[model samples]
Target: MTPPISRSHPGLRAVFELAEFLDHGQKLPEQSRSLLAQALQECIADGFDTSLFTALGITQWGGVPAVKKIGLLRRDRVLRRLRSRIPEWASLSPNAAAKEMSASFRRYETTRWPRERHSAKGPAAQPNSIWWGLLRSELGVPGEKRLAQILKAEIQDGFEFPKGPATVAGTGEHPENTGTNIR
Candidate 1:
Protein backbone atom coordinates (compact mmCIF):
# COMPACT_ATOMS: atom_id res chain seq x y z
CA MET A 1 0.00 0.00 0.00
CA THR A 2 1.20 3.51 -0.75
CA PRO A 3 1.45 6.14 1.92
CA PRO A 4 -0.97 9.03 1.59
CA ILE A 5 0.26 12.51 0.80
CA SER A 6 0.38 14.81 3.80
CA ARG A 7 -0.52 18.34 2.75
CA SER A 8 -0.40 20.02 6.16
CA HIS A 9 2.80 21.89 7.06
CA PRO A 10 4.68 21.59 10.37
CA GLY A 11 3.98 25.22 11.18
CA LEU A 12 0.30 24.50 10.71
CA ARG A 13 0.44 21.53 13.06
CA ALA A 14 0.38 23.72 16.13
CA VAL A 15 -2.46 25.68 14.66
CA PHE A 16 -4.28 22.45 13.92
CA GLU A 17 -3.61 21.24 17.43
CA LEU A 18 -5.20 24.38 18.76
CA ALA A 19 -8.07 23.92 16.33
CA GLU A 20 -8.58 20.35 17.46
CA PHE A 21 -8.72 21.42 21.06
CA LEU A 22 -11.26 24.04 20.15
CA ASP A 23 -13.30 21.59 18.11
CA HIS A 24 -13.36 19.06 20.91
CA GLY A 25 -14.07 21.66 23.56
CA GLN A 26 -10.78 20.81 25.24
CA LYS A 27 -8.32 23.26 26.75
CA LEU A 28 -4.89 23.56 25.23
CA PRO A 29 -1.71 23.15 27.26
CA GLU A 30 -1.16 26.45 29.01
CA GLN A 31 2.23 27.26 27.54
CA SER A 32 1.34 26.41 23.96
CA ARG A 33 -2.01 28.13 24.15
CA SER A 34 -0.40 31.15 25.71
CA LEU A 35 2.10 31.47 22.89
CA LEU A 36 -0.66 31.22 20.35
CA ALA A 37 -2.58 33.85 22.29
CA GLN A 38 0.40 36.18 22.19
CA ALA A 39 0.84 35.65 18.48
CA LEU A 40 -2.85 36.27 17.99
CA GLN A 41 -2.70 39.51 19.97
CA GLU A 42 0.18 40.73 17.89
CA CYS A 43 -1.72 39.87 14.74
CA ILE A 44 -4.72 41.85 15.90
CA ALA A 45 -2.59 44.73 17.09
CA ASP A 46 -1.07 44.73 13.64
CA GLY A 47 -4.63 45.05 12.30
CA PHE A 48 -5.82 41.48 11.96
CA ASP A 49 -9.14 40.34 13.34
CA THR A 50 -10.48 37.38 15.30
CA SER A 51 -11.33 35.94 11.93
CA LEU A 52 -7.62 35.92 11.19
CA PHE A 53 -7.17 33.79 14.30
CA THR A 54 -9.77 31.50 12.81
CA ALA A 55 -8.08 31.78 9.43
CA LEU A 56 -4.82 30.71 10.98
CA GLY A 57 -7.11 28.13 12.55
CA ILE A 58 -7.25 28.81 16.31
CA THR A 59 -10.23 30.00 18.30
CA GLN A 60 -11.18 27.94 21.29
CA TRP A 61 -8.55 27.10 23.98
CA GLY A 62 -6.37 30.13 23.24
CA GLY A 63 -5.64 33.42 24.99
CA VAL A 64 -8.54 35.67 25.92
CA PRO A 65 -6.71 38.90 25.17
CA ALA A 66 -5.98 37.71 21.66
CA VAL A 67 -9.57 36.78 20.95
CA LYS A 68 -10.94 40.02 22.41
CA LYS A 69 -8.37 42.05 20.54
CA ILE A 70 -9.28 40.31 17.33
CA GLY A 71 -12.93 41.12 17.86
CA LEU A 72 -12.22 44.74 18.71
CA LEU A 73 -9.91 45.25 15.74
CA ARG A 74 -12.47 43.75 13.40
CA ARG A 75 -15.17 45.96 14.86
CA ASP A 76 -13.01 49.00 14.41
CA ARG A 77 -12.21 48.23 10.80
CA VAL A 78 -15.82 47.43 9.93
CA LEU A 79 -17.14 50.60 11.51
CA ARG A 80 -14.57 52.62 9.64
CA ARG A 81 -15.55 50.96 6.39
CA LEU A 82 -19.26 51.37 7.03
CA ARG A 83 -19.03 55.00 8.06
CA SER A 84 -16.99 55.72 5.00
CA ARG A 85 -19.17 53.85 2.55
CA ILE A 86 -22.63 54.57 3.94
CA PRO A 87 -24.14 57.98 3.54
CA GLU A 88 -25.80 59.52 6.56
CA TRP A 89 -29.51 60.28 6.56
CA ALA A 90 -28.09 63.19 8.52
CA SER A 91 -30.85 64.40 10.84
CA LEU A 92 -33.05 61.29 10.58
CA SER A 93 -30.42 58.58 11.02
CA PRO A 94 -30.43 56.83 14.37
CA ASN A 95 -27.52 57.60 16.70
CA ALA A 96 -24.57 55.28 16.10
CA ALA A 97 -26.89 53.03 14.14
CA ALA A 98 -24.37 52.55 11.37
CA LYS A 99 -21.64 51.69 13.82
CA GLU A 100 -23.88 49.19 15.59
CA MET A 101 -24.85 47.55 12.31
CA SER A 102 -21.25 47.44 11.16
CA ALA A 103 -20.13 45.91 14.44
CA SER A 104 -22.73 43.19 14.13
CA PHE A 105 -21.67 42.43 10.58
CA ARG A 106 -18.02 42.32 11.59
CA ARG A 107 -18.78 39.85 14.32
CA TYR A 108 -20.75 37.69 11.97
CA GLU A 109 -18.08 37.76 9.25
CA THR A 110 -15.21 37.05 11.63
CA THR A 111 -17.08 34.21 13.27
CA ARG A 112 -17.70 32.62 9.87
CA TRP A 113 -14.00 32.16 9.00
CA PRO A 114 -13.65 28.81 10.74
CA ARG A 115 -16.03 26.97 8.47
CA GLU A 116 -15.57 29.17 5.46
CA ARG A 117 -11.80 28.90 5.50
CA HIS A 118 -12.06 25.16 5.93
CA SER A 119 -14.09 24.94 2.80
CA ALA A 120 -12.16 27.57 0.94
CA LYS A 121 -8.79 25.99 1.60
CA GLY A 122 -10.00 22.82 -0.10
CA PRO A 123 -8.89 19.25 0.64
CA ALA A 124 -5.28 20.31 0.24
CA ALA A 125 -5.47 22.12 3.54
CA GLN A 126 -6.95 19.19 5.44
CA PRO A 127 -4.73 17.06 7.63
CA ASN A 128 -3.25 13.89 6.16
CA SER A 129 -4.81 11.58 8.73
CA ILE A 130 -8.31 12.25 7.45
CA TRP A 131 -9.56 9.24 5.54
CA TRP A 132 -9.50 10.06 1.86
CA GLY A 133 -11.80 7.18 1.07
CA LEU A 134 -14.63 8.73 3.03
CA LEU A 135 -13.86 12.34 2.17
CA ARG A 136 -13.54 11.67 -1.55
CA SER A 137 -16.78 9.81 -1.54
CA GLU A 138 -18.51 12.69 0.15
CA LEU A 139 -16.90 15.56 -1.79
CA GLY A 140 -16.23 13.99 -5.20
CA VAL A 141 -12.68 14.26 -6.56
CA PRO A 142 -9.54 15.32 -4.70
CA GLY A 143 -8.60 18.42 -6.69
CA GLU A 144 -8.84 22.08 -5.70
CA LYS A 145 -11.58 22.98 -8.16
CA ARG A 146 -13.74 20.12 -6.99
CA LEU A 147 -13.25 21.15 -3.40
CA ALA A 148 -14.18 24.77 -4.18
CA GLN A 149 -17.30 23.73 -6.07
CA ILE A 150 -18.32 21.50 -3.21
CA LEU A 151 -17.86 24.32 -0.74
CA LYS A 152 -19.75 26.79 -2.89
CA ALA A 153 -22.65 24.42 -3.18
CA GLU A 154 -22.62 23.83 0.54
CA ILE A 155 -22.48 27.53 1.31
CA GLN A 156 -25.33 28.34 -0.99
CA ASP A 157 -27.66 25.61 0.19
CA GLY A 158 -26.55 25.35 3.79
CA PHE A 159 -27.35 28.81 5.12
CA GLU A 160 -30.29 31.15 4.90
CA PHE A 161 -30.75 34.83 5.58
CA PRO A 162 -32.75 35.67 8.67
CA LYS A 163 -35.99 37.55 8.44
CA GLY A 164 -35.76 41.19 9.55
CA PRO A 165 -32.01 40.93 10.00
CA ALA A 166 -28.78 40.09 8.17
CA THR A 167 -28.11 37.16 10.49
CA VAL A 168 -28.16 33.64 9.21
CA ALA A 169 -30.42 31.04 10.81
CA GLY A 170 -29.43 27.47 11.85
CA THR A 171 -26.24 25.77 12.97
CA GLY A 172 -23.49 24.68 10.57
CA GLU A 173 -23.73 20.97 11.25
CA HIS A 174 -25.08 19.83 7.92
CA PRO A 175 -23.12 20.24 4.69
CA GLU A 176 -25.90 22.48 3.54
CA ASN A 177 -25.90 24.48 6.77
CA THR A 178 -23.05 26.97 6.76
CA GLY A 179 -24.24 29.03 9.73
CA THR A 180 -22.23 28.57 12.92
CA ASN A 181 -22.83 29.75 16.49
CA ILE A 182 -19.25 29.62 17.78
CA ARG A 183 -18.69 33.33 17.49
Candidate 2:
Protein backbone atom coordinates (compact mmCIF):
# COMPACT_ATOMS: atom_id res chain seq x y z
CA MET A 1 0.00 0.00 0.00
CA THR A 2 1.12 3.57 -0.66
CA PRO A 3 2.44 5.49 2.33
CA PRO A 4 -0.07 7.71 4.12
CA ILE A 5 0.40 11.39 3.50
CA SER A 6 1.75 13.42 6.42
CA ARG A 7 -0.12 16.42 7.95
CA SER A 8 2.93 18.48 7.04
CA HIS A 9 1.94 18.35 3.36
CA PRO A 10 1.32 21.83 1.95
CA GLY A 11 -2.02 20.82 0.47
CA LEU A 12 -3.16 19.37 3.81
CA ARG A 13 -1.96 22.46 5.63
CA ALA A 14 -3.94 24.73 3.30
CA VAL A 15 -7.06 22.61 3.78
CA PHE A 16 -6.70 22.82 7.58
CA GLU A 17 -6.37 26.58 7.39
CA LEU A 18 -9.47 26.79 5.19
CA ALA A 19 -11.42 24.62 7.62
CA GLU A 20 -10.42 26.92 10.48
CA PHE A 21 -11.55 29.94 8.47
CA LEU A 22 -14.92 28.32 7.78
CA ASP A 23 -15.36 27.32 11.42
CA HIS A 24 -14.90 31.00 12.27
CA GLY A 25 -17.77 31.96 9.94
CA GLN A 26 -15.49 33.75 7.51
CA LYS A 27 -17.43 32.44 4.56
CA LEU A 28 -17.62 34.15 1.19
CA PRO A 29 -20.70 36.28 0.54
CA GLU A 30 -23.55 34.68 -1.41
CA GLN A 31 -22.80 36.63 -4.58
CA SER A 32 -19.12 35.81 -4.41
CA ARG A 33 -19.84 32.13 -3.75
CA SER A 34 -22.18 31.89 -6.75
CA LEU A 35 -19.73 33.63 -9.07
CA LEU A 36 -16.83 31.51 -7.89
CA ALA A 37 -18.83 28.29 -8.31
CA GLN A 38 -19.62 29.21 -11.91
CA ALA A 39 -16.02 30.16 -12.62
CA LEU A 40 -14.74 26.89 -11.12
CA GLN A 41 -17.15 24.85 -13.27
CA GLU A 42 -15.95 26.72 -16.34
CA CYS A 43 -12.32 26.13 -15.39
CA ILE A 44 -12.92 22.40 -14.93
CA ALA A 45 -14.63 22.18 -18.32
CA ASP A 46 -11.70 24.00 -19.91
CA GLY A 47 -9.29 21.43 -18.40
CA PHE A 48 -6.36 23.12 -16.68
CA ASP A 49 -2.81 21.87 -17.30
CA THR A 50 -1.48 19.22 -14.93
CA SER A 51 1.45 21.52 -14.20
CA LEU A 52 -0.99 24.02 -12.69
CA PHE A 53 -2.15 21.41 -10.18
CA THR A 54 1.46 20.48 -9.46
CA ALA A 55 2.32 24.09 -8.74
CA LEU A 56 -0.54 24.22 -6.22
CA GLY A 57 0.90 21.16 -4.44
CA ILE A 58 -1.95 18.95 -5.66
CA THR A 59 -1.06 15.47 -6.80
CA GLN A 60 -2.88 12.47 -8.22
CA TRP A 61 -2.63 10.71 -4.86
CA GLY A 62 -4.67 13.16 -2.74
CA GLY A 63 -4.85 16.96 -2.67
CA VAL A 64 -7.17 19.85 -3.33
CA PRO A 65 -8.45 19.92 -6.90
CA ALA A 66 -8.20 22.95 -9.17
CA VAL A 67 -11.84 23.82 -8.54
CA LYS A 68 -11.29 23.96 -4.78
CA LYS A 69 -8.16 26.10 -5.22
CA ILE A 70 -10.18 28.54 -7.32
CA GLY A 71 -12.91 28.59 -4.69
CA LEU A 72 -10.35 29.24 -1.95
CA LEU A 73 -8.84 32.10 -3.97
CA ARG A 74 -12.29 33.62 -4.47
CA ARG A 75 -12.99 33.26 -0.72
CA ASP A 76 -9.74 35.06 0.00
CA ARG A 77 -10.89 37.89 -2.25
CA VAL A 78 -14.13 38.17 -0.27
CA LEU A 79 -12.19 38.16 3.01
CA ARG A 80 -10.04 40.99 1.65
CA ARG A 81 -13.18 42.97 0.85
CA LEU A 82 -14.47 42.41 4.40
CA ARG A 83 -11.18 43.61 5.84
CA SER A 84 -11.28 46.74 3.68
CA ARG A 85 -14.89 47.60 4.56
CA ILE A 86 -14.38 47.09 8.32
CA PRO A 87 -11.49 49.20 9.50
CA GLU A 88 -11.44 47.32 12.83
CA TRP A 89 -10.45 44.17 10.93
CA ALA A 90 -7.11 45.73 10.05
CA SER A 91 -5.98 45.88 13.67
CA LEU A 92 -7.76 42.76 14.98
CA SER A 93 -6.05 39.42 15.55
CA PRO A 94 -7.38 36.30 13.82
CA ASN A 95 -9.44 35.28 16.87
CA ALA A 96 -10.81 38.80 17.19
CA ALA A 97 -11.72 38.88 13.50
CA ALA A 98 -13.53 35.57 13.91
CA LYS A 99 -15.51 36.88 16.87
CA GLU A 100 -16.38 40.07 15.01
CA MET A 101 -17.43 38.12 11.92
CA SER A 102 -19.64 35.81 14.00
CA ALA A 103 -21.40 38.79 15.59
CA SER A 104 -21.81 40.45 12.19
CA PHE A 105 -23.31 37.26 10.79
CA ARG A 106 -25.81 37.13 13.64
CA ARG A 107 -26.84 40.73 12.97
CA TYR A 108 -27.15 40.10 9.24
CA GLU A 109 -29.36 37.06 9.85
CA THR A 110 -31.56 39.04 12.22
CA THR A 111 -32.11 41.78 9.65
CA ARG A 112 -32.59 39.43 6.69
CA TRP A 113 -35.26 37.32 8.41
CA PRO A 114 -38.53 38.27 10.01
CA ARG A 115 -38.89 38.25 13.77
CA GLU A 116 -42.58 37.30 13.98
CA ARG A 117 -44.42 34.22 12.73
CA HIS A 118 -47.74 35.99 12.08
CA SER A 119 -46.11 38.99 10.46
CA ALA A 120 -45.20 37.03 7.32
CA LYS A 121 -48.11 38.19 5.19
CA GLY A 122 -48.24 41.31 2.93
CA PRO A 123 -45.39 43.58 1.91
CA ALA A 124 -45.17 45.60 5.09
CA ALA A 125 -45.81 42.56 7.23
CA GLN A 126 -42.97 40.74 5.59
CA PRO A 127 -40.67 43.71 5.71
CA ASN A 128 -37.57 41.62 5.13
CA SER A 129 -39.12 39.72 2.19
CA ILE A 130 -42.34 38.24 0.82
CA TRP A 131 -40.85 34.76 1.21
CA TRP A 132 -39.97 35.48 4.80
CA GLY A 133 -42.74 33.14 5.89
CA LEU A 134 -41.01 30.14 4.43
CA LEU A 135 -37.88 30.77 6.45
CA ARG A 136 -39.44 32.55 9.45
CA SER A 137 -39.25 29.59 11.78
CA GLU A 138 -35.72 28.86 10.69
CA LEU A 139 -34.36 32.34 11.48
CA GLY A 140 -36.27 34.59 13.89
CA VAL A 141 -34.74 36.70 16.59
CA PRO A 142 -35.81 35.98 20.17
CA GLY A 143 -36.83 39.62 20.67
CA GLU A 144 -36.59 43.13 19.23
CA LYS A 145 -34.25 44.11 22.04
CA ARG A 146 -31.51 41.82 20.69
CA LEU A 147 -31.81 43.39 17.24
CA ALA A 148 -31.80 46.85 18.76
CA GLN A 149 -28.67 46.02 20.69
CA ILE A 150 -26.96 44.80 17.55
CA LEU A 151 -27.95 47.93 15.63
CA LYS A 152 -26.80 50.16 18.48
CA ALA A 153 -23.45 48.45 18.64
CA GLU A 154 -23.03 48.67 14.87
CA ILE A 155 -23.84 52.39 14.80
CA GLN A 156 -21.46 53.08 17.66
CA ASP A 157 -18.76 51.06 15.92
CA GLY A 158 -18.43 53.35 12.89
CA PHE A 159 -21.52 52.53 10.87
CA GLU A 160 -22.55 55.74 9.11
CA PHE A 161 -25.86 56.69 7.52
CA PRO A 162 -25.83 57.37 3.79
CA LYS A 163 -25.55 61.07 2.89
CA GLY A 164 -28.64 62.79 1.52
CA PRO A 165 -28.66 65.03 -1.55
CA ALA A 166 -27.37 68.56 -0.99
CA THR A 167 -30.10 71.21 -0.93
CA VAL A 168 -29.04 74.54 -2.44
CA ALA A 169 -32.10 76.81 -2.27
CA GLY A 170 -30.86 79.91 -4.10
CA THR A 171 -29.25 77.88 -6.93
CA GLY A 172 -32.55 76.14 -7.68
CA GLU A 173 -35.70 77.69 -9.14
CA HIS A 174 -37.44 77.63 -5.75
CA PRO A 175 -35.44 80.48 -4.19
CA GLU A 176 -38.02 81.24 -1.43
CA ASN A 177 -38.11 77.56 -0.30
CA THR A 178 -34.55 77.40 1.23
CA GLY A 179 -34.79 73.64 0.44
CA THR A 180 -35.48 72.85 4.11
CA ASN A 181 -38.96 71.45 3.41
CA ILE A 182 -39.28 67.84 4.59
CA ARG A 183 -41.86 66.98 1.94
Query: Which candidate wins on TM-score?
Result: 2
TM-score (all chains, Cα) for each model: 0.26, 0.28
Worst 10 residues of 1 by lDDT: 125-134
Tens-digit lDDT track of model 1 for 1-183: 223212242223444456446444556667657667777777778777545445444453334433443333222332232333444522223334433433443443356433444442222221111112122223212233333232223222111222211111123131113222112
* lDDT, candidate 1, at 9: 26
Q: Which pairs of residues clash in candidate 2, taking residues 3 or more apart in a chain or in different chains?
A: none
What is the C-alpha local distance difference test score of each model? 0.34, 0.37
Per-residue lDDT tens digits of candidate 2, residues 1-183? 334344355544454344333434444445445444554565576675434334434443335444444333323332333434467754665456655655654554566433533442322321122123213323222233443333233222111112212111113212112311111
Compared with the true structure, model 1 gives a TM-score of 0.26
Model 1 residue 183 lDDT? 23
